[model samples]
Target: MALFLNTPKLNYWIPKLIEESEEELILIVPYIQTSKNVLNALNKADSNGVEITLVYRENKLSDYEKSKLLALKNINLLHHPNVHCKCYYNGDLLIVGSMNLYEYSEKNNREMGILMNRIRFKGQETFASRMVNDRTDVFDDAILEIREIINAASLEKASKKAKQTAFKIDIIKTEEDIVRDRCDRLNISFLNKKFRTVEYLDNKWFAQCENFFDKVDVVFQTHRIEITFRLEQNELYNLYRAWMQTYDLYEFHGFKYYWNKPDQELLVYKHDNFDWSTDNADCNKDKKYYEGLSTIIKKYRKITNK
Candidate 1:
């Protein structure tokens, strides 16, 4: 175990802690306001599939900071009303100290902390017993008891947050249900909504019915109708590509090639097509389009399981 005293340079160690995280990262800080470099590191850690749990006080995070933090895909932000513990830890290591993870603390304040090397007894003791601190090995049995106490505090905060999230999700689902119900009334099979854009996907193809970008269309228009088929599977895709090449086919359901790229590319397709213009009008045409697409999907599905 080592100690770092009056070290504003602790910001440098933050990145190291985040990078070294193997399974999970637990951070408890009262506030956070960090640089883009630090943010990028956190984003990179999230992209690596690390389970990150950040506990902080509410109202301490600014709107801009909150937006940036929320953008991370795999981070769980927990709000505690008066949390003051500034600790960063993972399964193998524990860093507990007076650091805010803020740019101001790194650049301005004198902070201090101790980094404890966790002792593990893999395959000998149970996973719970294996997690006891090296320094606290004398009271190894007490580790679980301490965790239980901490977990109760953490769970209380988590429950409150879960309620808020559940409420918001309920509102969103209710809105989607209402919209889907109305679309069903219009004799159209409604697809899932993503990014405020409603899509229809019953025909084994993707269709963008409405985009969040166009407010006028979202408010008044029932359907915007632009269908897309992803030639993602290999066998069926190869067959379809060969057929397209043989027939010199360019258009499908009044939609054209949105892109034509090489197979080596991650999103490459033999002939990717979608309709984005005036011709992709609602209801009857869309129904006809899906009906035509159903034949192709049936043919392809016969050859490949997908």
Candidate 2:
């Protein structure tokens, strides 16, 4: 038996549809300006872990409305541009209607709907495969159609939480991002290269070269960068010999050989500054050339025996 409903009945029964659901619910609404009672019922269903799938046309929604619905925890919301049919199902009952699940339609418009029992086969009445216009519009068929609609849509911002995943939207790069980028520009083996921070008194950034005692560390002071390295005395002489053969000590920043009496340690320092933005070409010469200071360091850092 099919029950015909006027606007007042639609207003009452839609929330009832959400309330009466035990296992699953599916709603396909084209313009979803759902009433407060309707939203409340859906929220209740979501809190109870009722599996729900909702399909609607995004072009008809306000920005706030779209965000409010997308914030729900358990409802799988989707968009389909070609759908205007309004369907509400709660496993056992199905309502197909001219009503849009819109508050204005329920309060003012002369809307109408038809509710029927969704039985697969009961005493020869097969509501699941109901015959209409020489075709079967099965209750299960709409479920499949909703699934297809979901599959066709991109899910990047579909919910920000389609499956309870944390999403980061900060596109701007940080100081750490810049440091890592410079490390990448160095001509070194990517698998063996690594960089990190040293948080002692003043925080500093350091890059490891193939797991050796000597490391390239950068200290950003105001706008100036103080590049430092620690190595043995013999390693410094070995590097300086090869470096002078091609370039001068000016390009080595301020490299020196500690030869006072019997000093043991070799420490190198270079002070410079540049535009720290993503314009890496201005900051560091990524290409092999006699262009930036970084290129000079990259060429000579590996020439030593240690």
- For candidate 2, the per-residue lDDT at 161 reads 44
Give the Cα lDDT of each candidate.
0.51, 0.56
Across residues 98-166, which tens digit of lDDT does each residue of candidate 1 receive?
Answer: 988787777778788866545432323432233435543322232343233234444322323345554
Give the range where candidate 1 is weakest over 10 consecutive residues by summed lDDT.
Answer: 212-221
TM-score of 2: 0.44
Model 1 Cα displacement at 34 (Å)? 1.9
lDDT value for model 2: 0.56
| Model 2 / residue 217 / CA error / Å | 80
Each model's total of backbone clashes:
0, 0
Please give the TM-score that candidate 1 achieves against the real structure.
Answer: 0.43
Q: Can you give the lDDT of residue 30 in candidate 1? A: 83
Model 2, span 58-128: residue lDDT tens = 57777877777766666666677777788888766678889986888878999889876544222243333
